[model samples]
Target: MRVLVCDDEQLARDRLKRLVEKADNVEVVAEAANGREAIEQTQEHRPDVVLMDIRMPEMDGMEAAEHLSKIDNPPAIIFCTAYDEHALQAFKVHAVDYLLKPVSLSDLEMALSKARTLNRVQLAELGKEVSEEKPRRRGHISARTHRGLELVPVDEVRYFLADQKYVTVCFSEGEVLIDETLKDLETEFGEQFVRIHRNALVALRYIEGMELATAGHHQVRLRGIEERLTVSRRHVAGLRKVLQSL
Candidate 1:
């Protein structure tokens, strides 16, 4: 079994590496100092399991695990933390097990052996619901492209158009289909984007002007995108006000 060890402390990571070496059939594939790096390494290495540290800087293990869970196949997670209280709470999500800091070799082996599959996506959802602190809003989304995970900066995003289950994320480079809902995108990026229609949330930066469409209909013309989004009757006034402010 391949494993990626993630911890902020160098000593902690080194100790875990030495201990992991003793376990039969287990190979340490990568090491990450923080949750963001952990997510990147997991994608690059495709490790079977991640020894995740909960209290990490930039992105906590819970949030990183949540993002990683969005992929086609996420690794089983075994949370390794200094806190014991987390054991009671963390299992509710997708984590296969939690190991207290200064983990015994036997416990590590047992945890690895017991893991049939990584924690479920529901586990990550539960983490979001419980925490008092919301996960840091990502400046870029990891959009899966034909080239793999493409990090699309939020600043470059032109608009998000909803079509049934998927939302097409239009950026400066191009557009990509994502599984995210329009409502969720609105909540997350409300400051940057405003609702122009029931089906669309457009970036304020991309709004060049509005033009009158056929028979009293209104359309928003974005800077670079060729598509002219129809402005819903209910939202036209609000869109005008937002544009007027800028």
Candidate 2:
């Protein structure tokens, strides 16, 4: 199996490369020094598997994996990191396996076996052409309003504001405060919404444009909505890119 090894440390990459070469069925096809390079290499080499390091400069492995997994024919990812804290999150993203640092040849073999099995399963699923089905629109967003347990539809939503604990779903007709977090909503309705801040996720269709305000702050102007949304500095570039693509 073709494999790509990614790590910020040159020594770590070299060590992993030797270990991968020692594997009977594994071929070390390429190597990357960071997450950005890993993405680029994955596109170019189309390796069957990638040995990813969790933390790196420019982009973290989790973020890179999220983007890479969305590619047409993404390689199976096997996270090789020293930190064990991210094992659960790694598995949540459908990683083949998580191998701790100083990974033994036996551990590498086990990960490889799992990756091959997963690749076969994914290919089989892809071979069967599933009929295109329309996704059902959310009829109501369960929220705590004055009446409690209020159901709000898509049209009624103006924008979603994120607070410390809860996300306030504002509507033209009436606002409803939901107990859900912004990250949870992002996963549920990523196609219909855009994350304008780490704390906020807003409906894409309602966004009119963004304006540069004082102190280099950015504000999102929503169509038919009176409240202007704040865009965090980290998300400004991404929001601008999404708007330009629209």
Candidate 3:
């Protein structure tokens, strides 16, 4: 099996490479120093399995795995982290197996043999669990592009529109669809954005003013965006209260 090693430390990467070389039926195909490079190498080499470190400089394993899950026929992911076993129960809940740091050869073989491919739903769940545990929300949002993963800084995003299961993030450059719920996003970015409608969250910084859509309905006008989103009757009251506060 082709395997990719992703860790921030050079020593960790070297040790993982040696162990993977000794393992039967597995070869070290690529190595990455951070989660961003992991995504790049994973795309280039198309390894059968990826040994991902949970914490890294640019991105973490959970975020990388979320991006990797979008790839067509994505590789199996085995998170290798120094996090305590009990703390990693969330990963196990979603059926994504993990190995503790200082990985044992036997554990590596077993993880490779039983590594399960993560579907979009499971990946979404994994992201949710990670978000719930994090003390601060992620500074950037990741979306799948035609080439690879795209990172949109939370500050650059102007608004978010919910479409069924996906949230379309409208940013300074353009918009990209992501597998995150509107409610979850509102909770995470509540300080920066306000819920304008049940299906949309508008950034407070972009708010120009409100316009009347019809007799009683209202619409919010953003700075650069010409198109305005409807303010549902149910949400109008809360939106007014928020606007007054602002």
Candidate 4:
């Protein structure tokens, strides 16, 4: 199985790589010096497993893992960290296993064994869900619009605009305002959505591409949809990353 090792320290990374090599079925395919690199490598390599460090420059492993978990066919993650305090959060994000630093070969092997088993189960479950949901295409977004609750279906939807208090579900049929913020929708419908701004969430399949506009701004072009959605500067990097993965 292909594996990616991520650690800020060169010694730790090399140690993990050697340990992975000792395993019968596992191979260390790539290494990262930080969480940001880990995320980039994850997109580029698509490894079956990631040995992630908990803390690093640019981004923390927990945050990167959280984002990585949203990707389609995400690798089974095995967090390799020195801190034991983060074990609970690691498991909360559905990590396959956690190995403390100065990792033992036996422990690494055990984690690898568990990761292989868990990855199989995860892939199977993902396939089943995708087949079962048949995820609605260009369907209505349930939200509060005008003065009351409203449902804005695909044909009518112009775009989804996010504000601090709510997400305005704009459609040709008329806009429906939802009380829930973009973050709420992100957690609820992450599979069908892409984040363009910290406050904004756009349907993934609807996004055609991104346009570089004047004044260092970027706009998202939606497929079968004319309205352009604004991409926040902070989220532009993440948007670009996700697009590249697709």
TM-score of each: 0.73, 0.54, 0.74, 0.54
Residue pairs that clash (backbone atoms under 3 angstroms), model 3: none
Give candidate 2 misplaced runs (Cα > 4 Å).
Answer: 120-246
Arranged by TM-score with the best first, the candidates are 3, 1, 4, 2
Q: Count the backbone clashes (under 3 Å) in each candidate.
A: 5, 0, 0, 5
lDDT of 3 by residue, 208-241 (tens): 8787887888999988878888888887888788
Order of the predicted models by lDDT, top scorer first: 1, 3, 2, 4
Off by over 4 Å in 3: 85-96, 116-145, 163-166, 179-181, 187-191, 208-237, 244-246
> In candidate 4, what are the lDDT values of residues 1-246, reduced to their tens digit?
999999999999998999999999888889999766786687778899999998887666775665455456777889999999999877666678898988999999898888787755585454344323332222334442243323354445545577777778755555666555666556656767777876677877667889898999999998766678789998889889989988
Error (Å) of candidate 3 at residue 34 is: 2.6
Q: Candidate 4 deviates by what RMSD?
A: 14.7
RMSD of each: 4.6, 15.1, 4.4, 14.7
User: Local distance difference test, per candidate?
Assistant: 0.81, 0.76, 0.79, 0.73
Per-residue lDDT, model 1, residue 159, is 91
Per-residue lDDT over 170-204 for candidate 2, one digit per residue giving the tens place of the 0 to 100 score? 87776767666676667667888898877778888
Indicate which candidate wins on TM-score. 3
Which pairs clash (backbone N, Cα, C closer than 3 Å) in model 2? none
The parts of candidate 4 lying over 4 Å away from their true place are: 120-160, 163-246
